[model samples]
Target: MGDVVRAPWDAYFVTGFDTCSEVLRGRNWLAPDFAWQERQDDPERWGAVATQEMTKTLSRLNAPEHTCQRRSLGNLFDRSTIQRLTPVIEEHSARLLDDLAEKLRWGEADFVSTVSEQLPISTIGSWLGVPAADHPHILEITHNQVYAQELLPTKSELATSAEATGHLRAYFTEMVRQRRAKPGNDILTGWIHHWDAREPDRETADEILYRLTMFVTIASLETTATLLSAMVGLLLGEPGRWAWLRENPGHIDAAVDEVLRYDPPIQINTRVAAEDTVLAGVPIAKDSMVHVLYGAANHDPRRTENPDAFDIERRGTHLTFGGGVHYCLGAALARLEARTLLIQLLERFPTLRVTTPPVYASRLVFRRVTSMGVSI
Candidate 1:
């Protein structure tokens, strides 16, 4: 068990792996009640407009409502659906790697821009049926929107994020319109059909659809990019790890899992007490904020042997995608993207080298690499 540490603003932090798991899986704990209201008041608080919009998303909903939306959306991300997209992921990875190789010929390249950032956003944009030409705009909007979640935003930052959010909403609205008129074989089209079948009033259904689309788009892009960047930094940090990966390409899945465990993308998850209750012997009040320190739990020695060591062969799971009803909808997609990129990279450049140390981003909720220089 872990101690309950007090956080700023009278909130509590849950650090034990088992306890955190309990909190995540428990139905009594719920999404923070004031999350949306807080974001609405100060648009720059967490994710600005994006966070404000997500206040209405499935992740923020309770039981029956969450259950319905999750079930309907679940089919879109099932194993078979994700498996069919492998070739698309591979094609994107190969193209990005080809670009990286060309940049390396000029001595060095910024891997974060050339590969880490580009691959995930591009792949996700394609998956969402965003035209290739519109990907850059969407990526810019999502990057600004997602980065705002890292810290309390400045007035200027908040203004910029709010503007980006408007652009995103406009874009999504147009896409939704297009999907409704002429359905396609894309995830968004599937979601639209699902929402339509629900038969809710037009305004209510549209609101739900737009919010859900924004939530999925931002979540998929930001976390996937963060994971890829972190994996690259970790692999290249040690002397033999890169070469080891090249020799043991079969270990890519385990390596990806290990990376998720050692350095998860989203570091903290928050919940609020739905009713007055005791947790791990601690007293609780309704609506009290409880922070689940996923990063800390992942590193907890009691649950993981040699927790600090980055052993790819470690045989266990981490809370990187969270757990229970709120588990990440894109978990499989993320793993597939990472595995595809790593395999393709190792096969293409057997002697990958880090040209410079990686610079990490400073954020409260997410661990990300801002830039890294590398060469083949």
Candidate 2:
């Protein structure tokens, strides 16, 4: 726990920023009402606006169901599996740099929409057997779909997102059909064959298609992009820090972690307590809302030395990537993507510097610097 933690809202069950060991308690730590998401409460109404295909599978899953789903999917992102994806990571990153070079040369570029957004889309598209030309469209659709829950309005946005969902489902359905006829080495191809072999009737090939693609694409895209923005954003503003990277490139990973700690890509996680429990000395009934504050906890001076300073040499755990059962499955992939992107940025623009203050996304949940003018 840090000195400046975002304590539980109840205020009576507990207080102060405490170590995760204290606040989280156990692997089964569920504050009151953690499972009660706002969207799920009005499924019928939101389904009219959200992707009908995803509501039951993703947004409505409770802890037990989520645990089971995560377990099966977790194996796909295991340390070994993720390590094997490095070549894919390297290839996508190199291509991203090449694309950026062509798109903007000796001119102003919006780093977020143009560059940061390309990474996970390319990687995920490649993994899913999606055609390269279709990645940008997929990213646009997925970006809206991911945020539809928190910030969305009017029927027009809903119609556009719904259309994307249909396109995606149709695309993956065709891809699965192709993989079934002629299986390949790709994950999409493998999963199709594997699921049919194991569960047969229960786990049909296309049953998990759309949601899985959403899980793969959007999860990797947003977090990785935000991390890249935060990491590069900080360095671009401080010439001395950029110079340090030019001198010692190996320190990039530490700086990436420091970025997550200093200004995390993700600021908070929404939780609903599974049952009645106490948090920070506050008592609560079942299903209370819980938020693990990443920003405040990362700045807690008790847990970190000079928590305010963005020092690459500093070492401590950060909750930018949630905790326990809800830990981001894509953490390793996001790290790899950010690291590779940083390397490419260094090689392409060693003297890169920010020409103006970065313009960030308005969303509070996801800390993304949407635009940063850079000069090479």
Report the C-alpha lDDT of model 1 over 1-376, residue by residue, as the tens digit: 3556767765789998988999999988997534424533343364456556656677677777788878877655677877788999999999998898888888889988889888888888888887788877887887676544543556676677678888988988877877888988777877777777795687667777787887888888878888998888788778898898888887899999999999988998888887899887898887777889988999998899889999887866799999988988889889999999989877888778788888876677866677888877
lDDT of each: 0.80, 0.65
Q: What is the lDDT of candidate 1?
A: 0.80
TM-scores across all candidates?
0.92, 0.83
lDDT (Cα, 0-100) at 154 in candidate 1: 69
Give the TM-score (vs. native) of candidate 1: 0.92
Residue-level lDDT tens digits of model 2 in 1-376: 3222344443222212364434443533552222344425655435554544554453335567566556556466777777778888888778777766765676766777667787777777777777889877777666665544343335765666567676666766666777777877887766665566656574353676445655666667777887887777887766588777868987888878888888877665545555687654556456554555677777777778788787887767677776666566778778888888888898887777766677776665666666776656
Q: Which stretches of candidate 2 lie over 4 Å from their true place?
A: 1-63, 78-83, 102-104, 151-167, 202-205
